[model samples]
Target: MEVDATALAGLQSEVSQLADLFKRRLFEDRSKNALIESVQDQVRAVNDLLRYREFEGLFKEALLAIDRLQSESSTPELVDSVVDELLEVFRRRDLVAVDDSGIFDPRVHEAIGTVPASADLRPNTIAAVHRTGYVLGDRLLRPAQVTVVVSVDD
Candidate 1:
């Protein structure tokens, strides 16, 4: 009994491809796990913030103000708990953006529109955020859509 050389070479090629596929799958799995962990950490932060009683009071009152907001028909207390935590997050200013630079980058700032301001004052600076932003590990959890002011050279 003897093995053919061509058959062995073909077998080796197949094995190599399989090995590469396994490696890629493993890397993807690890990358997805990291993303999941990062998201979980952010969720935990909100949960911790919501645990305060005062925050809960304010959150409930605000929700009650909603005209068409559904107050959770699925879980009895789940909606209340989650809303309190999320509202607490907003109330505490958990979402923030700080830039000493007088210029706004489109990547970091989603400019809804530009405003007119003095060159000595508002040189392309971030005026205000239309919506709040979130941060995670030095990465933007959400980009702040803000209005920036540009100084026109007269």
Candidate 2:
């Protein structure tokens, strides 16, 4: 039996289509997994914030955000909910460290003024954080508005 090239070409086309289908499915699966992992991370971060040891000492910023957004959209935005859920850190001096290091950050901190300090303290060191900052996971929801310090050279 003599096989024609047309039949073989048709078979090759079908195989190519099948391969593409499988490739697309694989890509979709991987993308979906990545999305799920991101959502999980956000959930975990939010959970940690919610169950913080000093829950009452956190702040009223979160609560204020919630109050403003709750009626506007009522969609349960994470930051807004946190605002509502945690509402005690407002009236006192319980500012959470925006950055682990007391480094100066112009982004979150407004350079209202600068001051002189010790030799070890370089300029832009956060001598005082006038305003507390908030974090949403790895993202900085709000930068810590602070006063930077500079070392007075002799």
Residue runs of model 2 more than 4 Å from their true location after superposition: 57-154
Tens-place lDDT digits, model 2, residues 24-96: 9999999999999999999999889777845644434555665666657565476555553454344343433
Off by over 4 Å in 1: 1-84, 87-103, 119-121
Best by lDDT: 1
lDDT of 2 at 121: 70
What is the C-alpha local distance difference test score of each model? 0.70, 0.69
TM-score, candidate number 2: 0.35
Which lDDT tens digits does candidate 1 get at residues 48-146? 876776467656666664422464454646666665655555545444453424478766667887778864456678776687555544677677778
What C-alpha lDDT, on a 0 to 100 scale, does residue 85 get in candidate 2? 45
Which residue pairs collide in model 1, if any? none
TM per prediction = 0.36, 0.35
The Cα error of candidate 2 at residue 38, in Å, is 0.6
What's the lDDT for residue 49 in model 1? 79
